[model samples]
Target chain A: MIGSWMTLPLVLVAAPPPPLDPDPRASPPAAAVEADPKAEVPPLPLRDARRAEQAPPPDVMRAADNPRVPKAKPGPPFYDAADEAVFRARFDLTKDPAPPPRTVRMRCLVADPLCGITVEVQALSAYALRAQQGSVATANARTWHSARAQYDVWVQFPAVVRTIGRTRFNVLSMGPKGGIVASDGGDLWANVGLAMRAFFGKGAFAPHLEVTGALAFRIGGFTEGGAGFFGAGRTDLGPVRSPVGFAMDIGVGLGGFGSLVIGGQYDSPLAREEVPESLRTPAAGMFYVGFRGNILWGAPAAAAVTTHVLAGRLVVPER
Target chain B: MRAGVRPLRGRAGVGYRVHAVVILPLASVLLVASLASPAAGSEAEAPPRTNRYLEAPPSSAPAGEDFGPFFTGPPASETSFVKAPRRGSGLAPRLSVRDGLFCFVEDAHCVASLLASTDVGIGMAIIGENGPDLPYAQLTFRGGFSLRPVTLYRKRYHPWALGLTASYSVGTGGIRLQAEDVVETARTQATRIALVNQLWLWHRPHAFHLDASIGAVRSGVLGRDERIHDLWGTHVELALGFGGWASLVVSGDFLDEDTRIVFGFRTHALAGVPVAGLTALGLWAGGVL
Candidate 1:
């Protein structure tokens, strides 16, 4: 028991000091012990172990500080914080928390060919970076710098190609109840035409209009050589271009696919001398209705539809 | 009075003949040739206009890198261990079924689906005739088939396409009265049949089409007299399909003294095909322009 008591004092004296707090966030002890002014400084953790290991010995450190001592090639290790600071200054490594230099591409709004600008944006957030890029693409899309010529086609209905008119064109010539005129010189006539179309709307259904002009070929009524309605067999009165024919249509456009339309047409009276004054009747008017459909080219709706069909998406999917 | 009228009639007849034989034909030929010249020219002569929306997205690859190196096989030493006999027959038919039948959707300007590129459609128009009574209207049914032949200055745009078109028109009633209508009477119906060969020109197939055709017509079906006549025709067609599926046609048909105008529509030949439809859309958008 006497010997144990004697050794306890020695053991107490030999015990090592407790380790400093590993976490910097921990508060210091309230009753902090004042550090000795002349005591050797405690070594710091290896924040930069490489530079620490390369630290010169005391004598070399002192020699490095003294310019009088001729230094070897590549010089000596940094002797103090000031020396390290000076070295870092030369290499520009002292700047702390340094992030990579941010960069962005910019362009002029006036469509200048040499307007591309590389901007060194500093400290932009992730969201900001994306916004920058997206805006650039938008600008590019809106800019006319790379604008190319564009052309689009207009399709109209009842596109008129030719026209002719004859007062008795269809009345006395080619009617269903026409056997009354037996003479070969009786009134008979024919007219031909072509048309065009137009549209003014969007989507699968829209309003449309069509105008047509007739291409008149055979237009005069047959001349009656004999007297009455029961004269000789019918004879052609020959072709004439006196009257005019026209047709118009208005209805809904079927999304460039075709049209659901209602239309009417008219052929004017023949004003030619071929027909006798008695046989010359007023212009024959005819009206008919039907549905016509057509395809559209270079239409935005076409592109959207194609994308949807092929990829099952209205827009091209991002990779 | 008769002598005075005779001289006037003679002058009028001479003028009409001159106009028909010279001025009219000359004008028609000039109009068609002028419209078709651009399509006949080489693509290089008139490069397609660029479209901003069609530009390719910007690439992020590094500059000056040789892509060839990436595609090349590894060193011979590494490949030596994998040596094996070639499996496929060395001689294979040059044209594959896929090449003839299919097309890539992204490539709008390619003519890869030639085998299925023939256009066929049916059309209708109103016909007018001077019958025994007031002017009457009749319905005309038309069926057409067309094929594009190879052109000298061909490129992706295919602005100019020389085509052979065969068409048949069935006219009922009117000027050519229906045989049934004339059966009760002493008269016979004069039905007409016509065929056409067309030359097509445009920036894109779906954009515009200017065609001039010459064919033959035969008239007087079920009639006492059957007459055959030479024919000529012209057409201005525009494709208004947003989907590039159909086109509107304005056509003129002339058979001797008879002339007719018709408005019609034609659906794209390959519209029903799987990938070719996309190609049609591309071509309509001025492929690669």
Candidate 2:
């Protein structure tokens, strides 16, 4: 008993001093602490820790000195200290919650965006001193797509020689029942067309050909006046201005006419661009073999017709 | 086996002219008789205008361009993939098939399937005789309409299409099909309704198109022991052609657990009309009127 009493005094003196309260709400009044200037003050846990590890303290005023922030002015104590009791009582007693979620900034490299693509640069959250960059990969994942801009340069390549010119065309005139018709020589008809084709794989694709099937359209019977109540009289038509629709099909050592172009074209009735009220019969589904080389270039020839009427085949209405 | 797939496609022979001779007269007579009826009547009054120069030239339009319009502008130098819209319309021969044999769905006996011609006309296909499995079946005949009414494309190179077909086939043979539990045997006629989705890859230089379609097929038999088989079928086709208006087609079809392939060649300017189409199956020829 005598020895225990002797060591108790020494053990109590060696123990560490109790830590100060870190929470502002748990702190005593400033006046009360001011009276004891020598008392050690508690350090703000989250605010000080994050600041020390991350960046320099913000340049803007802190919550304590900011004019915009509410001060502890004695009267009415901010919340009728009477009615807001429960709401205020439930508030957390921690210093500065988690750091604010990162704010992002986006920038582009070019203004006009040439070479066929638009590029964007963004700056994510980072630590200045440590020079650590935040992740941006997830957000940029969905930026690529089929509609994205593209650039291509054609390079000359040697390709095998192959025969060109082998398209079939049906040029026929139908009377009321699709028989041979000779009305005023069956309304003399002529067709001239031109097309510009961008060949892809060199030789064969040098001029892309457009292929179409029958009038897969069921317009509810526009020509039902035919024999036995036949439905559609016109064959299904594709575009009249296929990239390579009209070629220089000059008959050299062949049996075909000098000008052979079998494609869909519209003259009037189906015109979608010009004056809407113009209801002329659309010259569609006719297989025409133009022997005249009156028109040499294709673009002007195509523009000549397309400008007047719709390209007979299948085309979307103008926006 | 849809009507618009491939019906009569195979290794073509040198009988290109012979094929045309047989179908020409038949088509002419039929067309003449049909024309004897009356001019087709339309609800609208305006006549179809075939003249592109009907209107006087505008100051800027590229009309009266008699010589050469070659070497155009910006569109020429810049190269990009083609992007086509949905809902495209096109016409083909009356009796064309993309793939999946019509007769193969039931017998795969006497005849092979016909490939749908890219041309616009009417056609027929008939194959005589069959294997021992369908001894009674003397021949098979099928005909119908095939159309590609809806088409979508990502680029000119990647084309997608939806095909609608309605066709009828008659096989004069005993339906010798032994299912898991039931056995069916009898002579009957079959009708097929099919919708197929197609993917077309274009080989620009050769003017070649490689296409494939897959979809649902319903083969319905009309007879005493009528039955229907619902299944999926696929068809693949390779077409080669020169620019302008002529092409050779070879296609393969797999339907009703059987495979059939056919070949054909089409010429545009021939025998009076602007277009002439000939098929190897029934040796039929039809042209646009």
Candidate 3:
């Protein structure tokens, strides 16, 4: 045990004594540096060593300052809070809502030629778009200018003919029943007429006018002669009669999509009475008042063709 | 057989006797008249002067006139002549009267006459004269007036007259046969009125009358009890009148049913004045009135 104790002392003596200074050389230098009023400092090597221990790695510093880097403003918050609420209330965005496509519609109104106030309507489709265009427009800068207004006029040609068929004349003399009486024979003939019109205005406030003309042919009458009671054999009194004439009409019209028109016409004999002996007799004048209307399938302005119906009262003045 | 023969012989004998009796008398009369005619002619040709004494004489003869006993003084102006008065004192007074046939007036200044008449006719609707079916017949009635007055100094031969006619008709003659029914009953009726002026052109052996009427006609039909009425149907008719008091009138008329055209003729007989004593017979074919 005494030996073991002696070995332990030796072993203790063998262990290196605690160093009074961490590094004899480092301590002296550090002490010398501390002690010296102006010591020549070991610049490069020591400065390098101190910097290596204290400075952060480049990657770590980059990571730490990343939040402070200037960022894009997030772009006006994708959508406002109210906008989000509206979107959610109106549609189920999660379900993917579909968008409505664009569409366009157009219409028009038309007028009758015979009666100005008559309006008709017809259904039109895209096929009629080109024909219905009222004017061509061109854009200059920001303003659109129309080239010209185009008008489509409708005309009516009468299919049936009518005419003044016959005329009977009488003469009154000085005595109550006194006078030589004469009469012309009855005649038959045919007449043809044409009408046209143009309208201006919109909706129910539109106004229009129409003009019409008709030519009648071969209207004449015959004469007869003496008989009994007159105290002699039969003798024809007047000569043969012949008459041809034309009539004119003008009228004002007012109406809307569908319209009704009423107007009057004054007709004067265009030719003189052909009966030589009957010239002394008074001439007859004719007149008529008529009503006309249009039945339209749709809007008046856009219809391709409209049906017009007419009725009238005819009158002829006494000779 | 013997008895039958006896009766036959007796009947023959009687017939012969009657024939002889009739023939002998007629022959004798003819013979006597033939013999007497010559004698009468001879006596007439040779009148004896002795017969003069038997003739009635005298005061019948005018003075300064040679008078045979049998001669009557030129029958006192056989042609009566009325002497013209100095002024208007002898003028014939006007005559005016209204009768069933006509209205007549005769005056020195003017002669005026007016006549009004009405006629209604009904005809049978029989399939055959003795057929076993009965349907409604057709009936027509017409009434009108005529005015004729002779004006002094007016054309002497031509008479101015104005006539007005308004007639109504109801019957069942307008039915048309269809595929479903070979013959069907149709009830038709019409009402019409016309004002016509008759201008007499000739008044000799025959009178030529020209007349025209402007009028309205309303017609309807009940086909198996379906009513179809056509109003506002206007028509004008022209007619030619011919012959003497017995006159023929040809007329053309228009009706509103599909605007059909019709024509017809009528004959009339007259006696007396313009307004009176007239009768008419008429037949028409074409579209129904």
Per-residue lDDT of B195 in model 3: 75
TM for candidate 3 is 0.23
Compose the digit string of candidate 1's lDDT tens values, residues B208-244. Answer: 3344444443332222222222234333233222112
lDDT-superior candidate, 1 or 2? 1
Give the poorly placed runs of model 1, Cα more than 4 Å off. Answer: A1-244, A247-267, A276-319, B1-140, B151-165, B170-205, B221-289
Model 1: DockQ vs. true structure: 0.01
What's candidate 1's i-RMS value?
A: 36.7
Among the numbered candidates, top lDDT falls to: 3
Tens digits of per-residue lDDT for model 1 on A194-308? 2333434321233444343432211222322211111122322222222334444443443234344454434456434533342233443333333333222333334332322
Native contact fraction per model:
0.00, 0.01, 0.00
Please, what is the whole-model Cα lDDT of each candidate in the order they appear? 0.26, 0.22, 0.27
Q: Model 3 off-target regions past 4 Å?
A: A1-319, B1-140, B147-158, B170-172, B176-187, B203-206, B222-225, B242-247, B250-253, B258-289
Cα lDDT of model 2 by residue, B64-94, tens digit:
1111121111111122211111010001111
